[model samples]
Target: MFKLTLMPQNLEVHLPANSSLTELEFELHGQESISFGCRSGACGACVIEVMSGAEALGARAPCERNFLASLGFDGEQFRLACQCRLAGNAVVSAVAAPR
Candidate 1:
């Protein structure tokens, strides 16, 4: 199993290995803060700041890397929630991208 924390909101969620963050969002749908657009990882709307447990997240996909880079975000702590699948456990905070 894996643990996930949605910071600021201080929400905690437990998920089995190989679970996608998208499922979490769906479970918490209508919350406004974790909103996502373009589930394919093409848009930055789902980006989140990883507060810890970086190693637990699966490898960053190519599309995710390219999109973040295009947005001038090079830090490993930043990731698109839509592109991430928990491999172990992670703590992250939802962040809205600049318009």
Candidate 2:
């Protein structure tokens, strides 16, 4: 199982390994702060900062790399929720671009 924490809001959810963050966001769509756009990973609307366990997000997709690079956000701490699938537990914060 994987433990996911949404920060500031401090919402925590448990999911199995290989679970999709997009699916989580979809299920919690009305939460307001946990936003999503272009679920295919082409947009940065769902960008998040990994507060801990960044490795749990698995590998970065090509679209995610391109978008993050274009935004000058070259680091492991930042990730697009749409492109992430949890491999372990992780704590993250919803953040805007240039993070």
Candidate 3:
């Protein structure tokens, strides 16, 4: 299992390894820890800062990579929660809405 910690709120969620982000999404539903829009990579509403254990997340898809790049975010720590899956424990913080 893996743990995902949402900062500020410090919400801790546990899930199986290689789990898709749906688990995290479900947990955050209706909460401001991270705001989700399209549930796909196109929207930046669910952006997050991977404070630690970035390896827990899978590689960025081409779509996600392009979107983040367009937003001027070039670091591995920046991610869209809607586009990420966790394979290990991770600590992340919700990013302010870009829109």
Scanning candidate 1 in windows of ten residues, the lowest lDDT window is: 25-34
TM-score of each: 0.87, 0.85, 0.84
Relative to the unseen true structure, what is the C-alpha lDDT of residue 74 in candidate 2, on a scale of 0 to 100? 77
Backbone clashes (count) for model 3? 0
User: Which prediction has more favorable lDDT, 2 or 3?
Assistant: 2
lDDT (Cα, tens digit) per residue for candidate 1, span 1-99: 888889888887888898888888666656644768888888788888899988787778777877887887778888888888898778899887643
After superposition, the stretches of candidate 3 with alpha carbons farther than 4 Å from their true spots are: none
lDDT of 3 by residue, 7-49 (tens): 9898988888877665665766666567777887887878888
Which of the predicted structures, 1 or 2, would earn the higher TM-score when compared with the native? 1
What are the Cα lDDT values of the candidates?
Answer: 0.81, 0.81, 0.80
TM match of model 2 to true structure:
0.85
Error of 1 at 67 (Å): 1.0
Clashing pairs in 1: none
lDDT per residue for candidate 2 within 1-99, as digits (tens), equals 878988988888888889889767555656755578877777678888899998899888777887887877778788888888899989999886564
Candidate 1: where are CA atoms >4 Å away? none
Candidate 1 global lDDT: 0.81
